[model samples]
Target: MTESTHAPLLTVRGLTRRVGTRHLFDIAELVFRRATAVALTGVNGAGKSTLLRMIAGLEPAPGATVTWTEADGTPRTTPLTPLPQALRRQVAYMHQHPYLFRTSVRDNIAYGLRARGLPHDEINRRVGAALGWAGIVHVQDTAPDKLSGGEIQRVALARAKVLEPELLLLDEPTSSLDGHAREQVIALISELAAEGRCVVMVCHDRELINLPGVVRWKLGEGQLDTKHR
Candidate 1:
């Protein structure tokens, strides 16, 4: 979809994070647009990951107010300290080194659906589709220990994709990849953005930051500088 057709998916105001007397970032306002991807860049110790975690509801942002726009255009606003369950259901967060279950790749991909109590048939269907979508169908029965770094990342992505989240938060997704593996992950990220999801990625990789049509947001000196809005 084109930028012109994109709508506001989430908005944040009065966001702040701090460690004792050290301020990480203090943003007055920020907006995440649907069908768009944002590459969040910053120097070491700039709290890029912290901000992402807060958005994913994995961290506390007592001063922040998050507003999510639902499919029917209903706006729901809440404090970041205790993000509502409704918001958590629509956001998915992926770590740079994703943790996988001890079971088979397919089982790992199906974990989320099982957690949500999806019907057996529907879970199976979604798991199968996620495996194929992530190009890991061949390793459906393989254990996590046997998979390579790239394969592990793919499996993690499939796990998240199966849930069909509205907002995807990725923290340095390609940091440990190289060659074909890096390319594969990059391609998957692009596909995710193309599907009309709001993708917020924290990375220092120039290639990912420069991905076609990715909006860049840099955090430094307790402020966020956004490029291309």
Candidate 2:
């Protein structure tokens, strides 16, 4: 792990995981910072997504421990592994093929807020802002399943944004996108990083990996290697 004077946004220790008989990762200590975009690249089945899932607390491996220091200097541990339902709102994971419910785009964006028991009016306010932010307000009333691949990507990102997450995990945001869609997702990523939202994304696209000011890392042989700025 790289050394930094500032405190990390999140820290993982004694983490180990495996799929069947193949070993995935055995990380001792890794620190993630805020307002940064991490582009993780590796060969197929190199455990890129596995690492993201672990951090998202979706799958907790044995001997794994995750922690983060609160703004008040208090540490949160129990709710670390297998992350609590409430904390999940602050740390979200987006798969390459995001699932869209049968509802309108606006409803889909507001789903998480609704689950959190936000008022109806508040949900509408946030959802409307998110749609405009993603430049998809025109299709706010459209069925999610009817959108194009790029539109779906934007909506998925907008979903993540509406929650005001401190950490956003993305898996191959541009893997299925065409040139234009790729550009759109890339632009959004830039904005997210600028907003100081910690973003860890799994992607191998040269266009994205070469993006200025992003932390480039390689995941191979169950290790994380810093390769760029």
Q: Against the true structure, what is each candidate's TM-score? A: 0.95, 0.93
Clashing pairs in 2: none
Model 1 spans with C-alpha error above 4 angstroms: 1-5
Please write out the lDDT profile of model 1 over residues 47-114, one tens digit for every residue.
Answer: 99999888888888887888877668788888866877877778899998999989999999989899
Error of 1 at 212 (Å): 1.3
Minimal lDDT window, size 10, model 2: 1-10
lDDT of 1: 0.89
lDDT of 1 at 60: 81
lDDT of 2 by residue, 19-116 (tens): 89877777787777888888989899988898888888877756766677766889876534667654676798999899999999988999999998
